[model samples]
Target: MFGGQVAEVLVNEVPEDVYLLDVREDDEWRTGHAPGAVHIPLGTLGERADEVPRDRRVYVICRSGGRSGQATMALNQAGWDAVNVAGGMQAWEHAAREMTADGEGEPRVL
Candidate 1:
């Protein structure tokens, strides 16, 4: 398994077309999230782990870094190639990455 440090990446470091997993709650997701990201709240990850792809690297993100860090470690131990988005959506917004909301208006990190 990879070390925690090795499993973390900044928003700018994330590549294009990757499997981005947003582990925030439904309300947070509706507020804002990376475009095309898959939603799997941290609480449901254990049962939904099977839904994450096995063949490619998965980038886990949350409000900040804590939850995604936990998820990164778990997924790595479970044999999935996972990495945490170090600063989460907060960093994503700071970096000016594309974001989409669930409904009307512009997307903003919450």
Candidate 2:
């Protein structure tokens, strides 16, 4: 719902206890992604919700805002401290950050 070059600022400003959750598919993630993101596809979120850490806040992201927003709502309903990353990966790309792939076809901090 919002857009701007605040990825770095947001990432840096958040408390160290917060976590970044990437809901994009395996293929989409393998191309590149934000640093310090956890890969958890949206389709399997229900079953994998327990995998999310309850000890900290969560910022959700996907290819765009839509899926990330949906994931945020789901997490909120499930009692996790989750928020949508507003513009998702598109915004990160717009911000000119680099993305890297991992062995599991997921993105990792680079």
Candidate 3:
């Protein structure tokens, strides 16, 4: 991986117990995201870092891989155990992983 840090994990490889952090924007998160994933828009991550669990693995994801990649690096620097969900929601959706909307209705990625 980069500079001895662990490489990002593909969506399929993420363990169920790891905390899933959805770093997309508000609307994006409301649209659809991994079931049980915590919503923390990337822009507010620094202020909400404490909301993230430091003791458990954190799998970070965004619409694509870009935002999550940045968030992953930040989380690591902040001493949180974080990994980018490679390919992000796009890949997760492609993999046919279960997803849920904010409330009810069809779950469609934005």
Candidate of highest lDDT: 1
| Model 3 regions more than 4 Å off | 1-6
Where in model 2 is the C-alpha error above 4 Å? 1-17, 103-110
lDDT of each: 0.91, 0.71, 0.86
lDDT of predicted model 2: 0.71
Steric overlap count per candidate: 0, 0, 0
Measured on C-alpha atoms, candidate 3 has an lDDT of 0.86
Comparing 1 with 2 on TM-score, the higher-scoring candidate is 1
The TM-score measured for candidate 1 stands at: 0.94
TM-score of 3: 0.90
lDDT of 1 by residue, 1-110 (tens): 23535478889999989999999999999989999899999999999999999999999999898888988889988999998998899999999999999999899988
Ten-residue region with minimum lDDT total, candidate 1: 1-10
Candidate 2 residue 48 Cα shift, in angstroms, is 0.5
Tens-digit per-residue lDDT, 70-105, candidate 3: 899999888988888888898999999998898878
- RMSD to the true structure for each prediction, in A, is 2.3, 5.4, 2.2
Clashing pairs for model 3 are: none
